[model samples]
Target: MKEARYFYVPNAVTETELPADEATHALRVLRLKEGDELFLIDGEGGFFRAEVALTTSKKCVYTIKQTLKQEPTWRGGIHLAIAPTKDMGRMEWLVEKATEIGFNKISFLDCKFSERKSLRVDRIEKIIISAVKQSRKGWKPVVEPMIPFHQFIDNCTSAGQKNICHCYSEISKLDFFTEANQSLEEDILVLVGPEGDFSFDEVRYAMEHGFKSVTLGESRLRTETAGLFAVMISQLARRV
Candidate 1:
């Protein structure tokens, strides 16, 4: 028997043909043949146990054998918003790790002290997809385009406990885990700053706008690390 493989096929519940890129990978790279087992992930919330029905140089068709709907691993929603670091690699690494741990969404914030103002969201989306496939996560985390720090806060009026992590001592900060644990099933969002950290004014603005000031711990962490730490802590809180 041949080994089974998973492919990201959006709307796999209805669509029998894999996307062009996935089709190419299936035929050219994997050399999958007709009747090979294939697991299809729709990225929304459906998984289809399938087998290759037909294959050509550029196309791979599949026949669904079973339909499965997966339950989310964690209760509530975990959202992490962060300022992009100068090196794109660090941000990409964070996205991969956080996705593996599982989260509902991730957003990029253009902060006051941010070094890199712009980033390729498309490239980051690919990383998220790959992570979802690797971890066998049922739902894919949503990645938003980078937006100004203030603009994002202004538009975000959703129902959830919002927390912002920063380095200033003058402003009071709370323990992230303890705070996040307060409402296990409620949606939670954590904001992490850039290398230089959010300016005092930005911190004040967030605090004034209902974003609680929270610290990951006593140790100072880089931008990417802080983001991942927040993600891990949030997931842990929901698990318990």
Candidate 2:
């Protein structure tokens, strides 16, 4: 049997037409025509088997043949909240890789030392959607709007395991992997600071508010790298 082409359609259903971008890919790029079989992912844990019903230069329509629900292979959720980097490309790269690596959600932090105060949420979301389709992931990671660091901390609910990864050499910090392995909480939230790292006061505040201080490793990592490291460790912990 031929491998089915996969498309991302957030609200896919019977008789639903493919979105503009997806339609272009299906009609112009893939040259799919009526009766061609394809798969659609709604990015909310839904997989749909669809058959092309109509195709034109600018449009592609499909009818759902079957709905396939997929369960997550990994246990727990990985939520990484980090300050956006000054370079937008770096931030986009992190988002793409994190989604492919399988994380549940991502949030941006505006910290004391943050260089970038704003972000293009819409563009970043598109990157995430593309990554999801490329990785063949069933679920989509939520890209939350950028908010002040203090606001994010204060509004955080008292659930799951929370940790802050920073460059505080004086404070005793446990290896992220080690801490994650010993953690009993299934939902994990990790806070990573900006290029200059979190200020001493910010770290102290987070620690006071139930956020444990942890270290990724001895070598210093950039904001994006640290965030990805935290995600990987959190994911690995669940498998152990």
Q: Which candidate is the best by TM-score?
A: 1
Worst 10 residues of 1 by lDDT: 1-10
lDDT of 1: 0.91
Error of 1 at 14 (Å): 1.8
Error at 184, model 2, angstroms? 5.0
lDDT per residue, candidate 2, 1-240, as tens digits? 977699999878644889999898888878999999999998889898889988877888899988887878667778999999999999999999989889999999999999999999999999999999889888999989999999999988768888999888898897788878765447888999999999999999999898999999989998888888888888878753
Q: Mind giving the per-residue lDDT tens digits that candidate 1 earns over 1-240?
A: 666688888888778799998898889888999988889888888877999999887889899999887888788899999999999999999999999999989899998889999999999989998898888877889999999999989987998889999999999899999999987788999999999999999999998899999999999998999999999999889984
TM-score of 1: 0.97
How many clashing pairs does model 1 include? 0
The per-prediction CA RMSD against the true structure, in angstroms, equals 1.1, 1.7
Pairs in clash, predicted candidate 1: none
lDDT of 2 at 140: 92
- Judged by lDDT, which candidate is best? 1
